[model samples]
Target: MDLHYLDATPTEAERAAVDALLGSPEGGNGLDPGTVHGHGDAHNGGHPNGSGPFPAHGAAHGNGSAHGNGTRDGRDMLLPALHAVHDRIGWISQGALNHICRQLSVPPADAYGVASFYALFALRPRPSRVLHVCTDLACKANGSSELCDRLEQSFGPAGTAVDGMTWQHSPCLGACERAPAALAFEAGDPARTQLLAPAGTDEIEESARSGPADADREPPARESVPQAGDPELRLLHRVGVVDPDSLDDYRAHGGYIALRNALRAGPAEVIKQVTDAKLMGRGGAAFPTGRKWDSTASQPVRPHYLVCNADESEPGTFKDRILMEGDPFSVIESMTIAGFATGCAKGYLYIRGEYPRATRRLANAIAQARERGFLGRSIMGHEGVDFDIEIRRGAGAYICGEETALFNSIEGYRGEPRSKPPLPVEEGLFGKPTVVNNVETLVNVPLILIEGGEAYARIGTERSTGTRLFCLSGTVARPGLYEVPFGTTLRELLDLAGGVPEERTLRAVLLGGAAGGFVRPGELDLPLTMEGAQEAGTTLGSGVVLVFDDTVNLPAMLLRIASFFRDESCGQCVPCRVGTVRQEEALQRMAGGKAPPDGDDLALLREVGQVMRDSSICGLGQTAWNAVESAIDRLGTLSKGGPA
Candidate 1:
């Protein structure tokens, strides 16, 4: 979409590659019957003259070359593989990469390397609920830093000692239009202590500034810090101070104390602590951390692996980056405890390449932890329980966040997802059982190890108990992150995120990451819970909440998404490869204000989006239509509206 000024001066091979990628009879929506559900060639209906533009410098992906697309295979294979996969599996998951490898006679590692090299595959099991929080530079500048502060204030301390709650920060959840936003939250209970808010303080000064109508309004939200028997006062008590600046400050106030306590409790007690915490992965999937630890622990496995998935590429989500940069030790401690619980000797933190600052901080933290005897062999003087932490940096591929592909990348292979039946927990990283958790999920470990489970279960609603961290961004005075109970209403989050900027009409909101659907303005009052979001026909994927004022152009945004998918795609599956191209073409026509009034372009865009949604081989191609579909549902209002 950004290449229009280049004058279409593609080389003969480039032209041919583009043409082949588009194929003949391209008028129809790219969805075909072959893609509903099966395994087949990913390049069936593409160029027959062979993929034309194979970049010779494959090493660039590894060397972090600026020009490198960070793709694993030759660029030619990317298109074919995407087309082929689209033709077979309506949507791609971890399993498709293995099938592609089998058909291509490439090692699963090679295929996975390619898949992971791009940011489009969903390698991990889809969580029951997903949350995405934005932490882009713009968002950060607009108070994502403070938003992260609010979230940590609310969830950081509680998550560690409590059983049923957790939270983490990600980097650049990709909703650039909306800054300081997050997505996703499951059900959970609330703690009885007011550890976060000042006594009798109904609203924090900064939180008040973020609110609308109440811009000049201030009221006592709590009354006299109700007596010990006052349940209402307890539920309102969030667990931490507002924006306490340094990690050392966090330590002085009581950070890593849980880890120390867990170490004292020993592995069994530590495992029991987590089991009691009821903490679940906060990166969309709600797998119980303790349950995962329990399973990995009892299996009598050797070389069990633990991977901290810091590849937060989900659009509209970026909470992990904040945790890495602001609270690195929290995650580090969690990883160490996870190793202890699962008996793993080594663990890797797979961080995305986009955040250089976070990378440096994590490296520094690792060094600090080691020097303190908390990371290397015999951590904290625990005999026979040694674990070392290694940080693996991804070369700018969103799909590498997928556990399998991440594993492949760590092994020095291309980044592509692998098929699953035998999940990473049973057979992962180097063919050993592995427990991969999100940053927020890991951060909850030390807390759970310090507290009992029954107490943790009391926070949120059953089946979704615990607190959640939400990044709030969009047309608002104060956009940022907030940590609240699971059942908090969207209205409250909006108020906390600094209600929409004055003079802007709340047109629509995109919940979760790009994979989530949209919600109209009228739906703003919906509860900010996983089930509530689902009831609105969208998911809380990555806990990113993006607000669109009336001025946004939906079609342009759709085009942007199409271009993003097309560019970021590893080109392994047909539906995504070709379908994204087709969608982009249609969107280009619409964006250029040249679309015909007959509705042909609109129809084509819709058709292609539908096809890609139903036929891509991985989550990237599959969910690419989320934004498009949401926009279409809004009937041109989300876009500039030139045609149809």
Candidate 2:
């Protein structure tokens, strides 16, 4: 890599702003003085034990400065520095990258690698404003392609800046309820990032032409789902009924009571209750939540870590976003209880970068909780027990949803998954024993503790206990988030979502998101439980049920799904990197009438898929071919002569 390209330097004002945000003087490096290092002493740079295999990924170091204080080194500031430079100047100039690398002691090549990994960071010079339009499956069904075409007609082709703005098609923005979502990012004021759902040409044009002030206009109100007051709702009980911003309202609706009970019962009892409940993780893995907590607690390592995986980027899955934006306090309370049970004093909530509303609500909730003593030193006045949480935002990397990759992102590295064996529970975040649970998994903690594990277990099936959040999207009469038990049949779920529209027959259903397989309409009676889905050669991944009607172009949709995996693969390993590209090319050939009808492309696809699954490093590669494979085998996607 050439070093000269990274010679761009940050302006004096940009350096000052970053220093002020980090609370350090010029050229300072290390954590700020008195910054809590959980169970370890702050002077030791947060890692009491020696550095792990990848020290630069998570190790915190202190530099000998005149101030003699521990200021976070350049590695720790990678994300913040990127944000500062991008905010101060429209795009990350080579000068800015060089300046950031110099400040953090990061090599320019390594720094450039990290910067280019995320979708938000722009290495080359770009227009001050950028419009990221969603063209994923959910949005595509809702005319996102037409929206993109219209924008291109008005603002020129994708990636071209018209009147100082660039528009580009993007992956899922996690806002399926209000489909056709677009995010407007303006330079100079990062806080004013605007989300436009049902984004029209006029709205996007106005946003791009005007400055940040116009971009800050309130988004159109989303239509409310009909199931809010269904009485059976657990996770979403408070979503639409209560004011999301009002803490008093949340407390009034029996919030924090679970935390109080957990505190009274102590950590051991809390873990026991969870174990008894047999609660499975809702983030598709279905791992026993209690066992994960128990294993992390049993670790001999000091200063254990707890991570809340709120990076909900799975296409057509918006359940976590609904919970976070609606009941932010519950997430905070749940993380606190998780911290106590796992003997973790420090927690990190990694939310998706696209979820502006959820991010705001969570940040507000954390601040409010800290003020009320629910967080910070001696949480809720439990002397000698300290628990705190820090929110880390993801910079548009889908692979970061993986636990190890998320930890790496928090440690200021490229969001790529690490090899398993020293799994997260063994040697996870910061090279310590850590428990990483998704938002839905952590949200269940308080409920299990309050109702007693057995009582909670009675709500659902024996294996998949308790209620699950199902995201219903695509060509359905009522497409929204639905709360249902694990044993609920796919047919019943569709009925709850009001089924397909009048006169429309269901063609097929994608049981999960892109990483999940498909089930034909005939299998509607199949139970939506984990066991049933597996038996059907599919998965109830993230509880996403995307309904496809007779009018849908199945071949095109499968091709789009293939394209998504190809674009999002982190490219760390050969199987996934090359396999995804090969899979996409084969799918494109078949979809474009280029493949012979002798079934060679489909066979090649299956072979490539299996290789990726068997040899890939992470789940992203393993499941990349899921939707396409399922569509071809189960739904006759390619047999129907390409695109309808």
Candidate 3:
């Protein structure tokens, strides 16, 4: 392998751009480029240049500039540096990485590690223009695979560059509402990107070749949000009605009322409201939001961190994207409240990189909030209560959705989950007390503070309080986000989504995302609550209800699900790394009508799943087997001899 593509050497302009962002000279701070790169190849087992894993360039260097502690040594420069390089050169070059490493005093090996960890950063060379077509469940159901095939037929192979363009299959672009969505990055300039839904060969070819020309292109109109029966739509109220970009429109529609109430009540009172409301983490753990806030507040640590996890990489889930894109200010305000309640002065919003629209909206929202004094020092004129937020974009790691993994990503390391015992509340985000809440979870903070926790708690089941944002997609007439209180049966929720398409009998539903399990058609009446899901051997994880009808191929779908886990395992631990691959292999065998020699691939899958669940490091590996196992047990895929 020539492997020259892995060697990214920054030009003079690229180096200058990095210097402007990092506020440091190239190879500054007495760091020698030769020394850094000398050890770099050793740290990460050497570059793909046939040397070995990249080497550990140097020991960990600590600087606080990135986190707002104001140390100027470029410690916080990792993400920005990468972005600058990617933007200018279209990909990270080895020269660029070395320059960044020297500027930030980050070891060359570590810098390379960070760069390679994210999915967006291309390790190998390719065209500046790329088309990211979502091939996840919802998109797949809507012909995303066929779309990929067509694009490849028109442009080139999936990952090959042709006519200054390359198309790659993405996990989920969070545009399930407009299924079969493809985000085209014109010549790799993000600002020049275009989102095309119901994309076919023609649209993809034109978008890739002509770069967003109006001629012969009819971009699909934005999907409309379903009208909620209740006047106060709660989460879904402002989704379609209010202008996402207009901060004034948000305020007119009652945007920061919760923040105002939170400031009046004080941090303790705000936390009490959340605790009283019985709100839980919407990111799937369902831990009490109030309890998390209280724990962080009680800690003696100073500068406690509040992280709003907007990674939202789950296959069938797009609710967080909807919330962030439609009501960016709400997420910002919710984080502000969270920062105030936790006694933190700073927060980080880790939005998925694929969500360019959501990311842009949030960036604008944060700037507007800061300008309006809702953020920054002494927010909203609250004396001694200062809070600000920073946005961190994820490159494309599904595991980063886990709280600890997200912490690692922000700290300028590979996105990998940390072992628990200390927990995030005790030691997180730079080894201080931290609270990592999902976008939906934090959004509820404002609602709880405004309505009082007890009043808010009354909406859902006693244990699972408040309306949950359920992402409904696939084989349904109305496939979109629906916010319903807990205890709403799956049947009722499906009915709200207009149920399965006519004449298509519901076969199975994958509740939660890839990490969640399957629910049989007979179990549609099961309440969409944590408790209800637990009793039914499924979970309400992330509130992703992906419906599948009789026309779908369950065996192939299971194979795809398994393949997702295998590709996304991060390879940190043996159990998850190896187990996912094994599970995928077993599924492939079964799907191919060629079970293992023993003819018990299902048994082997169960054994492997048990090991992963009982021993894997993080939820990624632990829950990796949930969907596959559920399919084998509930849907008769294996017994029926795989896909027709």
Candidate number with greatest TM-score: 2
**Model 3 agreement with the true structure over 1-644: per-residue lDDT tens digits:** 11122355678866765664444443442344223422232112112111112222232322222234433234444765687667656677788887777666677777788888888887667777788888888888888878877887777778887888788888777777778888876422223556777687787778888665431142211253565445756877777667877889999988889899988888889888888898888888889888999999999866688899999988888888888877889999999999988988778788887776677778778768877888877777878877777777777899899998888787777888888878888878877788999998888877787778889989989888888888888888988778888899999999988988998888889998888988887888999888999999989998888998888877778778888999899899999999999999988887776864236877888899999999999999899999987776677667554334
lDDT of 2 by residue, 1-644 (tens): 22344435667756654554443334334233333212233211111111101122123332321111323344655775676667656677777677666555667777788889998778777888888899988788878888887887787889997788888889998877667788887766344577887677777667667734443254422243558777888887888777777778989998889989988998899999999999999999999998999999999867688899999889999889888877889999999999988998878888887776677777778767877888767777889777777666777899999988887887677888888887788877767788999998988887888789999999888888898888888888888888888799999999988898999988889988999998887889998788888998999999888888888888778888888888889999999999999998997887787986337887898899999999999999999988888887776677655335
Best by lDDT: 2
Ranking by TM-score: 2, 3, 1
Candidate lDDT (C-alpha), each = 0.55, 0.77, 0.76
Q: What is every candidate's alpha-carbon RMSD to the true fold?
A: 18.4, 5.4, 7.0
For each candidate in turn, the TM-score is 0.63, 0.91, 0.90
Q: Which ten residues in a row have the lowest lDDT in candidate 1?
A: 190-199
Alpha-carbon deviation at 368 in model 2, angstroms: 0.9
What C-alpha lDDT does candidate 2 achieve relative to the native structure? 0.77
lDDT of 1 by residue, 472-511 (tens): 5555555544557777887777776667778877766778
Backbone clashes, each candidate = 95, 10, 20
